[model samples]
Target: MVSDRSKGEVSNVEPTVCWVVALKSEAKPIISYFELDHQSGNNIFPIYRNDKLGHSLIISGVGQINAAAATTYLASESGAPPWAAWINLGIAGSMDGEIGKLYQGVKVINPTKEKVFFPGYRFSKIVSLAEIQTLDYPTPVKKNGVLHDMEASGFIDFATRFSCNELVFSFKVVSDNSEQDMKLIDKMVVNSLIGNRLQQLDALLDKIITLSKREKQRLQIPDEVEEVFKQFHFSVTMKNQLIQRLRKWKIQFPNRSISDLVKEAKTAADVIRNIDDALTDLKFDWT
Candidate 1:
């Protein structure tokens, strides 16, 4: 995937991790740590990238709608591949956790919409996990054990559409607790909170990157399958089915050529059926 930057140069690296942050203050530390270069001329959202690291960051303004829109914007602008990981990292108000503590959201609940999202593989060994609740407004009042945020719900909802839930994650650092004053949080403070947890973030990213690479390898379109598409016109649904069937065939008969089975196939349906039949024959043979 290549993205045309404002300077007219194209980024050759396809990002493996996309970070959606709600505030510039929250994004400051990450951009510096990753050494991401800002892309000029994108007025709607502040976009930053480090192609070498395969990491991209977008600063979405506060609110659920903004978060969702920015996530979509980043995906479009970056030309992010389907196998890329999507992460929403920022600060949240927590009632039970200590201020500046970082946590991975295991379960995200949108109270207003009554929607629940369980995202990402649990990095239990790397950081503490907590349940997050997305609210429309900032509530200084305590909410028991839930971490309060305004963006995770929207971020997760839109992000999962681009990538699987297993590759989408929300990690928040406690910026304000019941004992701490929200008004006291300045840009420097927000940066510090996020910066302090870079070590933990590094560990999480290592795991996520490995998972994304595995997914990329699994989802890669075979050259033979691409040739088949050139020969036959397949609808979106048919294309998906064909790809799925080919994946099974490749696993079952790695040394065999899928083209051999589909050479007699006159249509997309025939190609899929042929592959399915081959897989079935192998299953029965083993039994």
Candidate 2:
């Protein structure tokens, strides 16, 4: 079922999609995941083929450095044949927006230091693009302005190397404000909304794919090198946890390939596995 709207040169590009979530449990909140064959199919939002759309999601936990590091590693490792775009999708706090409304971030500004960052997306209105801003702590009061979050800025720098202007997109759903009772909205509620957010996400992907087609020629797919960190080995438990985190990063930056990330996992694992050795190594460095 090809969508009549799926008009574009079937360039040999499989857009790798990444979803970024704040919490580990919040990743891929959607219950039943479906793959569309073409944009013309029965499902809503001009369905497109799953194969043509390479997708991955990430849960970088909380904070800016973690988000940036995860993103940098993910981008460096995306082993997709022709990596397409990188997307950061998750919940955010908006000052002037209502709950459940999705905003294509036009400006990513840090309220703490007044640092401004822009998304790679092309927007008509003067809006902030999605950016990761370092907040001192969870915003307790709803100040004024657009969305607020922990990690969009970190992913932007690494993602830029892969695709051009249209290759990056930031989609955020308003979850809490300074006025809302955030305690009531626990893990269960956030998880439930993730399921609902997928629908809107599909719509966003549709629009993004169309844009990618228009600027396909000017796009420059990044050729990333894999540097396996052999410093340490990880135990089974630690390995699983790291993989879980890696999976979230992949989801956030779908364009990232498993091949690129496995090395980091190995390195991280080695460090965890040889804790004493790692400590000794650190001691040696200090000594």
Candidate 3:
């Protein structure tokens, strides 16, 4: 799978990870570090990609909805595989941290609505965890031992629908807090903060991509289904159903294949119903 990164001098390897950020400043260091180039021609929003680095970034402006939309665009436009990792990385306000410390948001809460999102497994022991609150605005609200951001909730909400829960993450670099002022933190400072942590982030991203690929392998449709798929003109929904039922069908009968039964089917619907019947028979007997 060759990934396209506009005019950027990147390799043919496609991106396996997507990063969503709320500000261009926050995205600057990552784009530079990964050697991403702007593809331009985008009228809906701005995007950058690095085929060799296996990363695609979206600058989602500054809010919850923007973040969600940008993430959706990343998944859609990038045509990322289900194994591709999704990360929301940017600066945030921390109640108790130095100006530039980094954190992985293990728990994300929308304080305005009291909605909570627990994202990703705590697989990386080296990274510190933070309890983050996603607020509606950039109001200076900070609490003892908590991280404050504006986009995490929306990003996590939409990303998990495409991949496993373990592949979604919210990474934060502290920019302000109860003592530190938000007004003082400018674009240059944001760029510098994230730039300083590229080394650490590079390693973290590698871990996430590997884990996502493993999870994808666990859930991806098998190659055997391809032969059957080519014989029929299946709708999008039918294809999904076929892939899912095929996996369950194989589990029910290790030696037998539903492929032989599919040979009798005349339409996509016929194949689906045939697979459904096998699945129904094996439901009680499958051990």
Candidate 4:
């Protein structure tokens, strides 16, 4: 159960999107695009935010561990709501993609840890999709059809824990490819790669923001449900069940009060049973 107090702690800023980038160069275009202000006093990781737009960002220096740690740090400092979207955006080496083409990482694999993570909804119309493999060190693209990066696997692995898989995304712009050499790429090159794709990035973000809002509504706990949580001693499992049932009940019978129906219930099980029984009774009546 999300108690009001806990909710208050995380709901203050109500950021709708959190971006995790591996380098300052990668973050530059996005920060400018979103008009996010640098949060002062945090040197461990450079954080930025625009409360009104519900956007927050963190620039992790480099590598998978840095990406993961920076993600966790941003989540903690930003206090982003659980429904907020998480995006890992940066440059990557591709086996065959165009030098500046952007692609969403449909599948992310961490070769070092032998972990695989599928992140984000398929926005087929907005951008191209590709497979991303995160490695410990920068290496030339040795395989075909895969985008090689150093941060996505770490970002996805940690970001999904803060939100859901559908809300966590990894987008990479091909900075170096077969024709382009990775060794020659510089900060200016990184900036240009990401900067050129801002328009497409905007389109993707608009869609994600829409989905995030819908998710926020679905996960919202009613005031009455909060009261029930305060009154009952629901275990973690029971709490989740109760919240799910309440959401369904609200949809089926929006005019009814779930709290009133469960007022006489003495325990957590009773609360769940009463709601289930009410839903069952309604179904039976309709038949």
Candidate 5:
């Protein structure tokens, strides 16, 4: 059944992670698992979102172009934060014997163009690793012991441009082996395969979310610091240094206002000196 076309509730908060998957069957597990709701106007391309889970998912139909376009749409429509993780999760044909096993994509290759993508810098302990080859159509041929899929290459190629390499990841569940017929697979079977691995997949999602949050905290520049920069006229280099020092200050004194430390300074030079003195006084030792 098509979703109700009425507008969903407006959220002041936005999701910090984006999930891209091909086919409605591939997306169903995530939508149910995450409790996502459809955003009304996005009927053109099915987009489901759950801000509380920090996830936004887009159904990209079943092609490389559709995958790429859907990912781009999720980023734009959901206001995907720069620090958010972009993941491509779907079913793939694998030569490996494990039909329900999940594997992290270490590398993605486009067989036709010879283009390659090395996505996600961090390694996962939860799932095994495998290479992926994206072809124009579903193929039983698993080149070089890697999984074969129809959309990962396009998704990864576009996703890497928007998010850092470390935050981009792909995980494929092996739905068919060389002996299994692709035509036999159905929604119930696909859903069951993903449903069986919920525990493991949830764990992987937790790790990815944790990493993304850490990156956000590190890269965020405090609004207070920005206000000061505007008033005092910090140079480009000085502004960068100020932001770094502000981050350290925040870590050391979580509740203290960094603005107070520089309030007494009459000039930009004094601001730097005061912060430097505070840095010298900080004790890094902890029990």
Candidate 6:
């Protein structure tokens, strides 16, 4: 994939990873209020540069809808190579912890009040996980999830459509407690607290991205080709048959070559297409 920064120039062979921020006001602390790039580019991902912290990232505007939209747009508009994963990074209110600490989200509860599990992948030896609930409105209330944020739901829903579960991650830096007024937490204060942690976050991102890229490469083999068959618009019966056949082959030969899988799948597609064509011809009857 080409980096938008260089127009069509293929910059990095490495899969691009998006670090999405929320609304302009929410993003001010990480990147400047005006510098958020909704546009596509290589250097386009929003980030804040502090002398202490190497770089911090941000997404779009706020709310679940805005968060989802921004995340969807980012996933679609690739300035960097198609990202391996979409990372939702921002500040959050924590009920159980002290301010300024960072935590990885392990579970996401929807605004409908249903608890949805969307957890981040484990990176290296570091254990970064938290259960979070997405609320319609900002709440100072603390719950079992540990932290409260505005954008992970949008990021998770959008990214999952394009990539696997391993490709989505949410890192929330605690800005204030549920009891504290969100209005009072300013950029300087955020910088003061999270500035040092950006490096850690970046390192973690690098690790996760590496793993995601590797996994994507591996799935490009037979499994993904089979997935395409199952997901593609085909007759339900044909899809089920194909899935069953593929499952049997996979079960028998745990490690099958992608070439064999592709051949088999292509043959199935050819048969299906031929059958459809024959049906159409039969439908023509005698003119």
Choose the strongest candidate by lDDT.
1
Candidate scoring better on lDDT of 4 and 5:
4
Give the better candidate number (1 or 6) by lDDT.
1
TM-score of 3: 0.78
Instruction: State candidate 4's TM-score.
Output: 0.82
Q: How close is candidate 1 to the true structure, as a TM-score?
A: 0.81
lDDT of 3 at 145: 85
Per-residue alpha-carbon lDDT of candidate 5 for residues 21-130, written as tens digits (9 for 90 to 100) = 89788788778876788888897688898776567899998978998999898888888877889989988898764788888888989979899988985556788888
The worst-scoring run of ten residues by lDDT in candidate 5 lies at 1-10
Estimate TM-scores for all models.
0.81, 0.58, 0.78, 0.82, 0.82, 0.60
Q: Give lDDT tens digits, candidate 3, residues 57-112.
A: 89999989999998898888888777778899999997777789889999999877
Task: For candidate 5, give the lDDT.
Answer: 0.80
Q: Residues 177-245, candidate 2: write the lDDT tens digits.
A: 666755656777676656666655665666666666556533332232112223345466765554445
- Can you write out model 1's per-residue Cα lDDT over 1-287, one digit (the tens) per residue? 12232113223388889999999999988888777899999999999998877889999999899999999999999999888999999999987789988899989999889999999989999989999999999888868889999999999999999998999999999999888888899899998999898878877887898898899888778788898898888999999998888888887788998769777989888888888888775643453
What lDDT score goes with residue 34 in model 5?
69
Candidate 6's C-alpha runs over 4 A off are: 1-15, 24-58, 79-83, 113-115, 178-180, 219-287
Q: Model 1 misses residue 105 by how many Å?
A: 1.0
Which residue runs does candidate 3 get wrong by more than 4 Å? 1-14, 232-287
Question: Model 5 clash pairs?
Answer: none
Which lDDT tens digits does candidate 6 get at residues 1-287? 11132223222433355567774444553454213233335343343322121222445667777777766665454432333666777778877666766778877778674648665675635635777666677877767447777667767877677667766787777787755677888767766655546556656755775676576545443455455565345566877655555544544455754344444444557644533443343333243
Candidate 3, overall lDDT? 0.82
Better of 2 and 4 by lDDT: 4
Q: Which ten residues in a row have the lowest lDDT in candidate 3?
A: 1-10
